[model samples]
Target: MTNTMWMRGVEWLAASAADPRACKWEWDHGEGIALLEAGRFWDVLSVPERLGLLTLDLLWRPALPVPGPTLVDLAAGRVGFFLPPDPDGGWVGAGLRYATRGSWVAVPPPYRPARSLEWLVPPDGTGTLHSPGTLEDALRQANGTLAVLAAPPRGPRES
Candidate 1:
């Protein structure tokens, strides 16, 4: 629907895919989805070091730190990890949104020193489905795993 971050993200993704060293994943941006044909994006989901990065600070931490390629959350309003769909079958940030700070804009990230999803959630129905841990702890763990992303490939760029 909205080109917003989705379009800009494609620019960064295009570069990362070409880099060969960058990890990539397939994302469904409503219109369609694409993959970077690079490394393993699932690396972020499986790694242990990534556990440390729960907040945006941790998300932006140097796991596979590619300052030039640019990284976008693609979920503009998403504060941390996954949250269940709202009653309307919609999510707070279910579309092509992204982190404003990282290598893009100047606005402060939504993540706190240690974020607290407990605080972020409204006291309404089905909020429990999205239960998460302490903000700081989650971000830390997530970032720990994300560190792998910061690394460049051992070999040179592929053709």
Candidate 2:
């Protein structure tokens, strides 16, 4: 993305904070990351890195449109995908963690990478976010794939 595009993305992300100016100041002063509230403009669905990676791969496999912003926390082994706020709290999946209203997420500056927490897919500055239904489908598929891979190999049938 161009510098202007990145700046726009940064602005979009900073707007998530209660005080966008403060958030921007933090980023400008080399704070690297800031905790932003969720469930206002968007919510976050976080999953284990392994599953998240698989889900992301599946999400990109087809000719489907690109997904929204995705943050990967290497130290925590987690990945957070941005989605439009769901007031009904409808999302549910094994090992899934949703950051809805009143929750806080440590977000990095969209213009640059942070230490352990960085964007796997940075925002495009259009307020675009992942479709909840589409993301849920991909998560289910990825979970199944992981389960299959983890299952023990079947031995020869008993004679």
lDDT of each: 0.28, 0.89
**Most accurate candidate by TM-score:** 2
Writing each residue's lDDT as its tens digit, candidate 2 over 88-129 gives 777777778999998999988987767798888899889999
> TM-scores of the models, in the given order?
0.21, 0.95
Residues 1-159, model 1: lDDT tens digits: 135433443344344343422322222222123333322210011112123123434434465221111122223323323232222322122122222112122111111111211212111211122222333344456555556677776987699
Residue pair clashes in candidate 2: none
